[model samples]
Structures are given as C-alpha cells and as structure tokens.
Target chain A: MTHQDVVAQLIKLVEPYAEGRVAHITANTGLTGELALDSLKVMDLITDVEDHYEISVPLNTLADIKTVGDLASLIQKHVGNDA
Target chain B: MKENPRLLAVRAVRQELATLGIDPFGIQIDEILSPTEGLIQGRRTILAGTNNYLGLTFDPDCIAAARDALESAGTGTTGSRMANGSYAAHRELELDLARFYGKRDAIVFSTGYQANLGMISALAGPGDTVMIDADSHASIYDGCNLSGANTIRFRHNDPNDLAKRMGRLGAEASHALIVVEGVYSMLGDRAPLREFVEVKKAFGATLLVDEAHSMGVLGEKGRGLCEEMGVLGDIDYVVGTFSKSLGNTGGFCVGDSDEMEVLRYASRPYVFTASLPPATIAATRTALRKLAAADDLRLRIRENAARLHAGLAALGFRLGAPANAVVAVLAGEKVEALRFWHHLLKQGVYVNVMVPPATPGNESLLRCSVSAAHTPEQVDAICAAFASWPGARV
Candidate 1:
C-alpha cells in the first residue's frame, strides 16, 4: 500500500484518541499537537497501529516521529520489510 | 509554554499533584526504626511502602556481615567487573545465584536496571525482535530502546496476545526475546508463567522473567514466581534485584544459555560500570543464605499480605490484585490518589503513591509492599489508618 493510503487509515485510528479537539487529521497533523495525546495515549495509539498492520515498530523510531506522515512512512517501511 | 512535550506533560501532571501542597516523591524518613517502622515527617509511621519483602535490612546477621566486610574491604570496589572490580565475593555471589536457580551460569550487574539493560541489549541487537509486556518497567523499555531492535509490546500477562505478536514475527519469532516480570511491581499480580512458557516453546523463542519482586517472597523455597508457578526450568533467563526482597543493593541474571558468559564481554552496562560496594555484596550474600533457609519469613509475609489486603478490602477500598505482597489500593484520578496518599500519611501510615504514567491505566495507586518484619498488630494498624479516611467507602 502507498504511504498516502497508510496515512488515510492512520487518521481513522488517531481520531478516537484526539480528545475531540481536532476536526481534521491530515498527513501533516502533529501527533503531539492536534491529537493532544499524553505519553500513555501515544503508546495506546502505537499499539493500535501495530495491531492494525501486524508490524513491530522499534521504540527508537519514535524519536524521529513528530507528524502522522512520519509515522505512516515508518509504518509503511515496516509493512514493506515484513512483506 | 515549553516546546518540549515530555516536560510539558510532566509539568501538567505535577501541577495536579502539587495542588495538594505535598510532594509525595520527596518524602524523607528521618529515622528508620526497623524494616516496617520509620519516622516520616515528624510522626512514627508504619513504613508500608518499602519493598522489604524478606525484611533482611536490619537482620543481625546481615548487619554483622556488612560491618565485617566494610572493615576488611575498605569502602568501594573502585573498578568495573571487567576491569579490576571482579572481587572474589562478586563471583562467589554469582555462583551462589546460579546454584540457587540450578542454572549453568550467571552474570551479576551493578543494579537491576543495568542487569536488564546489559542482558537485553547483548541478547538482541539491530536485527532481532523483542516481545515485552506492555506494562513492563521503564528499565525494560529502556533496554529495548538501547538494543535498537524491533520491539513489540503484547498485552500485559496475556499469552494469547503474545502468541499473536510472535506469530506475526514469522521467521523472526525463533530468536525473539520475550520479557515478563514475576509479580509486576505496580499491582503485584503475577504473570502466568506456564502459559507464557508454552507460548515460548510453541514459537521457539527465548523467555526472560525478571523476578525482582517475587524472589524471597514466593514459592515454598523462596526462589521466585517462576518456581511457584512450576515453570522455573522453562525460563531462558532469570533476572532479579537485591534492593527489594534481598533488602540490599545490586542485581543478578542467571541462565543456563550457552551464551550467558559471552554477554559479559558484549554488554556495555556490565563491562563499564563500577562494581557493587563490598559491604553490599557481603550483606546480600548473608541475606541470600538467610532467605534460602527461612520459610517462616516467606510465610509471615504472605500472612501479612493477606491481612492487609483483607483489611483494606473490608474498609471498602478497591484493591488492584489478590493478596501476595504488593497490595495496590486503586484511588481513581490523579488528584484523588494524591489526596488519599496524604490522608494515609497524616494517620501515621505511609505507602508509595503511584500516578500515571508510572501506574497502569488511569488508576492512581497507594502501593503497599508487605514485609515479614511487620507484626500482625502493625498490619491491622495500617488498615485502621485507611479505615479512618472518610473516603474509604470507595
């Protein structure tokens, strides 16, 4: 699947955890911003993402991630590598 | 207004806790009367928060050994184990731990944190995958990060969830490292070791159980939860801390794996850090022997755990898990938990106030660690303190 496709699906996953503050979750939506997710909620989101794609994301990768697009790109890489 | 998300988050949580005008983390025990009693603030308090399960801290044998070692061995080791610090006692303790578990070999680290970091990083590198429980300690998470491995967190204490995650790894499952704790520190609940061992075997994976809280508290022999659960032999690696049950300092890792000794050279945490102090090593050795020989202490702790658990329950407070040693009274919300902690303190009872994200889920906990040192009256007195709180009905 394309990175854009992953981003679209990720938007759906990120919505419920956004605390109703973000009306739209674009590819560039800041995870620490619009999502308003605390550290614990971010972890919950990561767990959901892993379950959805059945791919493991390295904990180190979170250091480089800030936006939904960055996460989608990383998730896409994991998906491709696992495939 | 800070741009740092981590700091901002902590600041927010701290503000909620700060409103109560008490810093639970900064509590100072003016004097320690025993393993179960201490002077906190100005009051003579029941020190329920200490993780002194075996209560060997003030044992005459332990104190005497430490004193003798201090006189003979000077103060510090002054070197790392890989360097000049592999004192005779360190290796002897390692051998003792290995023999205790019937493992082929063991490696002792500076602390339990380093034991996990050193072992996990050495076992799994860039190409490997690590499956850990979601509720694992911060040290375990740090180990995974340091390893730079593909880390997947399975549902806490759920073998089925782990199996699915391991299955998803495909070929990587064969060598994946699975980490779980025996008697998780937060709620004090134990892992289903048998079910986890079955999953490990099914996936052809390695299992590591950090029995930090369970050792010297569980099993008829005071080995750990792995022993109590009848799957001690199935675990590939067993790591634990002396700070808790041993009532001292330092950490250990015992395993029958062929590569156990090889990790000594490869692990940065082990190869670099200063060795444990001679006194701590000596005291722990004596404590270890005492823990092994005494079944009465273990039974005493279990009884105390049950009494406190039932006492708090009778007061209508919700407990996190069944009785065992750590009894967490779940006080929902950060503000409420903080208030409850102060209440306990005012009544001459002290428990570790746990808040998110340290605590699992959103439940704030008053974590009470039972000790063999506590008398039945002391345990009842602690429950009475909780019962005195008007919010006990929750």
Candidate 2:
C-alpha cells in the first residue's frame, strides 16, 4: 500500500479518538498538541492501527511518532513486510 | 523554540500540589516509632503507605543482625561487586535467594530498579523484542530504552492482548522478552500470571516476573505470584526488591537460565554501581528467613488489606482495585487527590499521593500499603479517617 492509503486509514482510526477535533485533523496534524491525546489515548490509537494493519509497531518507534504523517509512514513500512 | 520537557512535566504536577499548599514529596518523619507509626511534622501519624509488608523493620532479630554487620562488615561495601565489593555475605545472600526460589542461580543488584534495568537490557538486544505490561514500573521502561530492542506494551494484566501483539510479530515473537510484575505497586492488583504463562509457552518467549511487591506477601512461603499460581517453574527470571517485605535495601534476579551468568558480566548497572551496604545485606538475610516461616504475619497483613479495602468500599469512595495489600482509593482529579492526601496528613493519617504518569490513568490515587505491623485499631483509625473526609464519596 502507498503512504497516502495508510494516511487515509489512520485518519479514520484516529477520528473517534480525537473527539470533536476530528474535523481539524490532517497529514500534518500533531497527535499530542492540537488533539491533546494523552498516553493512554495514543496507545489506544496505536492498538487500532496495529490491529487494522496486522502489524507490530515497536515501542521504541513511538518516540518518533509526533504527527499523523509520521504514523502513516511507520504503518506503510510494515504494510507488506513478512516475518 | 524547544521547551524543556522536564520543566513542562514538573509544572503539570507542581501546579496541582501548589493549590493544596503542600508538596507531600519529602515530609520529614521526626521519629519512626514502629513499622506502622511515625512522627510526621511533629504529629503522631499512622503510616499506611509503607512497603514493610511483614513489618520486620523494627524486629529485634533483624535489627541485631544489622548492628552486628555494621561493626564487622564496616558499614558499606565501598565498591561495586565486580570490583572490590563481593563480600562472602553477598555471595551467601545470592545462594539463599536462589534456594528460596528453587532457581539454579541468583544475582543481586544495589536496588530493585537496577535489577529490572540490568536483566531486561542484558537479555534482549537489537533485532529482538521486549513485550512488557502497559503499567510496568519506570525501571522496566528505562531498561527497554537501554536495550536497543523493539519494546512493545501489552494491556496491563491482559494476556490476550499480549498474545495478539506477539502473534503479529510472526517469527519475531520467538525472541521476544515478556516482562510483568507479581503485584502491581500502584493499584495493588495481581497480574493474571497463569494466562501470561500460557502466552509465554505458546509463543516460545522469555518471561520475567518482578515480585517487588508480592514477595514475602504471597504463596505459602511467600515466593510471590509464581509460587501462588504454580508457575514458578515456567518463569525464566524472577526479580524482586529487599525494600518492601524484607525491610532492607537491594534487588535480585533469580533464574535457571544460563544467560544469567553471562549477564553477570554484561550488565552495566551491576558492574558500575556500588554494592548494597553491609547492614542492609545482614538485615535482609534475617528477614528472608523470617519471611519463609511467617505465615501469621502474612495472614495478618492479608486481613488488614481486606479490612482497608472493605472499609473504603463501604465508605462509597470509588475504589481503584480489588482486595490486596495495596488498597487504592480513587480520588479522581489531580487537585482533589492532593486535597485528600493533605487532609489525611493533617488528621495524623499519612498515605501516599500517587498522581499521573506513574498512576495507570488520569485518576489520582490515595494509595495505602497495608503492613502486618498495623494493629486492628490502626486499620480502624485509617478507615475512620477516610469516612471523616468531606469529599469521601465524591
């Protein structure tokens, strides 16, 4: 899958968690800042992403995931990778 | 444009405690009358927030052992065990710990935090994964940071979540190191260890259980949840602390794995840190023997735990966890938790104010760690104090 396809899916998964702020989300939308997602909420979103893609996002990678684009890119890397 | 994250984090907690007019971080205790009583701010207070589960801190035998070692072993070890600090007593403690757990080997660290830090970092490396509980202690997280391993968190105490995450790893799960706690220190909940054991076996992963809170408090002989659940033989490593039930200072990792001996040379935390003081080692040795036979002390603490849990539940306060040695009353908002903590201190009942980051969720906790030394009267007093709070139900 292309990065755009991954971003499109992530936006849908992150929408419900972002609450009413979903309307303002975009590729550059910051997960922690504008959306104010706490650590628990971030984990929930990551779980959803992992489940949706059947991927394992390493915990170390979480530090670099600041925006929707960053996460979409991460998901894209593991989209079709094998064991 | 980069704001210091440290300052930002401090502001979040400081502003809340600032409103309460007290920090409660380092309140000096004028005197320690017993394991359950202390003088805080010149007021006689019931210390319900200590980790002295067996209440042997003031036991004459343990104290005498410490005093004897203080004279003979000359206070501190003065260097790291890898250097000049591995005394005969240190080796004896390791053997005692190994025999107690029925493990082939045991390695001691200067503190419980280092035990987790040393083992997790040494066992799992680059290209491997470490699956840990979502609510594990900071030491576990720090260890994962140093490991250069792919660290992932499963839902706290949820083995199914762990299985799902590990399954996603495909063949990578085989090299994963899973870390969990015996009794979670925050909410006082025990891990679903049996289910976790099944996950460990099915995935062919390494499992480490930190019995920091449950040691000397669970099982027939207080070997922790592993013994309590009949999974002691399945776990790869068992890490624990001497500060809690042992009423001393230090940490240890016991296992039958050959990697433990290799880790003995590789763990930087073990190689660089000063060894635990002689008094602490001597006191802990005495306490370990007492822990093995003190079924009465365990029963008393369990009863005390049940009383506190039941009393708070009856008060209509939102309880954080089930009956355990740690009874956490959910005070909710940060400001409110600080108020409740401050009020308890003023009422001569001192409990811990556990706030965010360390706590599992946003709900702040008035955490009470029950001690075997606490009298029935003291437990009643603790319950009464909660009832007296104006916002007890809120």
Per-model chain B TM-scores are: 0.97, 0.97
Query: Residue by residue across B126-201, what tens digits does model 2's lDDT show?
Result: 8889998989999999999998899888888999999999998888888899999999999999999999999999
> What does the lDDT read for residue B383 in candidate 2?
93
TM-score of each candidate?
0.95, 0.95
**Candidate 2 accuracy as lDDT:** 0.90
* Cα lDDT listed for each candidate: 0.89, 0.90
Top-DockQ structure, candidate number: 2
What docking grade does candidate 2 earn? medium
B1-394: candidate 1 lDDT, tens digit per residue: 4579658766875676577797898799999999989998889999999999988999999999999999999799898988875889999999999998889998989899999998899998998989999899988998998898878888889999999889887888999999999989999999999999999999999999999999999987788999998898999999999898888988889999898889889999999999999899999999999999879998899899999999988888899999989999998877777888899999999999998778888778889999999999999999998888776455
